[model samples]
Target: MSRLPPAIFLMGPTAAGKTDLAIELAQALPCELISVDSALVYRGMDIGTAKPPSALLEAFPHRLIDIRDPAQSYSAAEFVSDAREAMAEISASGRIPLLVGGTMLYYRALLDGLAEMPPADAQIRAALEAQAEAEGLAALHRQLAEVDPESAARIHPNDPQRLVRALEVYRVSGMSMSEHRARQRAQKAGAGESERSILPYTVAQLSIAPAQRQVLHHRIEQRFVQMVEQGFVEEVETLRERRDLNPEMPSMRAVGYRQVWSYLDGDYARDEMLQRGVAATRQLAKRQLTWLRGWDGIHWLETSARDNLPRALKYLESLSILS
Candidate 1:
């Protein structure tokens, strides 16, 4: 067995009870919580991101949440770096790092590492933004499909940040983003396991979801409605008061936030915003599940199961990672 420190990844789609499970596990084990969510990183995005309440956060003390302003941008590479540091600190304190959230891309980057790509060129990004403004996002997506079909297929057409970045990588590096990732994969394939793995921790991957797809869909719809009742529109209204923020920024484009921002902008009515928000959340869950389904070595648990905490502990015991 490897002599690395132990870490736990509690992954699932939105409204899958992952936060509750992680909190239970933390209470049982000597673990520090590190959020693996992209949306939760932004400050003042509480209701929409489903961020833990301030009281709960003060008690549990999760790292990497609300670390950025809504006007700024955060990347997967930054997340990987911050997460590694947090994990190292937790391990040094003689505790395991329990990462919990539904952000599949962040989990993948932390696990497998990211490829080296060209740095962002402001001129290129500005040009792409202008092109998007003139020709539309669909046009940019079509252009990406021509050059990087794999990336185009993976990134949603509505994801302007990723879509723009993919095109920028092609423009700056003279190679598709997919090619850069493929090259990195090829290099890792020839390396030893220790060298290939970016994380030094012996990780236990756990995923929780409702047993039935329809159940999850229902839960998602209910959660979105709850968020609205919890002043989701007012939250967006406060954000709209900022001079620097806009609908196109990564933070604003989050599943529910975008719909609410559009509604506030008079682009749609409140009812339409509610419908779009719920649909967008369901789509996000679908994408997250698609990523997890292709993942290996995951210990699956049903959200409805009462014995999940014990089952997760049993898995850790089997791996001999629990001290």
Candidate 2:
């Protein structure tokens, strides 16, 4: 059945109740959600990353969750390819593909192909991580700016994760991240000229802006505490038992992991650890919101009330998306 792959993408910031709302929509519509989250892909990572409970899965079908071990590497490019295949499979199964996640890059990768970024070099990454630990992330950002001014111009100094990656890329490839990016852009443009290879999904993005920053901050703090009570500490301890996994790995670098890691390393005091974890999560949410706002071709829904899903559904329907 060669049909237009009918699908929808629902995206929003963290702690926005997207999970339940997505399942609710499934009841009224014929759809199965594919996770677009980078964090939710890891197996045995439930509390901190907040993978949907088993009951939710029984209620509505989901793809791309628990697809990778915590120690393994998963990239946006791989996600794009796998998710494209998943979409085809879902369509073949006579199901609608409704994708959900807060990971902006994954969403973009699915909507428009990601440029081929070079693979990570372990030794180079270790060197960069060591430098960040010994000196500071600011110095690393400066180093990246010195080497890849173009990428540095776009990446904020506070974005230590991306800055370190850019530095590592330059270290391994002998090409500035800027040059690599330019080359990728050229290739992407060439691909665009031939035909649109972007995933053919009926993307519908929905979101609710927190009216008060303090409320969002409060939510972040509460969620961190809940995750802690929900065995996040134990989860990190299990990951710690992995002799190969480093704190620099993308999975390990998630908000709570780093803080609990510092605590386990006997570095941070109890109060400092909690504060840092909560603060990092807030910052992450802020960055996610920035990315969501900056994205083009995204349909946003700003709801003032708690039951925002209905309004979001109505918005999608208004956009000529059928139920």
Against the true structure, whose TM-score is highest? 1
User: How well does each candidate superpose onto the true structure, as a TM-score?
Assistant: 0.94, 0.85
Q: Tell me the deviation in Å of residue 44 in model 1.
A: 1.3
lDDT of each: 0.92, 0.77
**Top candidate, metric lDDT:** 1
143-225 per-residue lDDT for model 1 (tens digits): 99999999998888888889999999999999999999998887777674543257788899999999999999999999999
Positional deviation of 173 in candidate 2, in angstroms?
6.7
* Model 1 TM-score on a 0 to 1 scale: 0.94
Per-residue C-alpha lDDT of model 2 across residues 222-316, encoded as one tens digit per residue:
98888888888888888899898878778887768888988889998878888989988887788778877777666565424766667767777
Model 2 stretches with alpha carbons more than 4 Å out: 1-3, 118-134, 146-150, 153-161, 168-197, 303-307
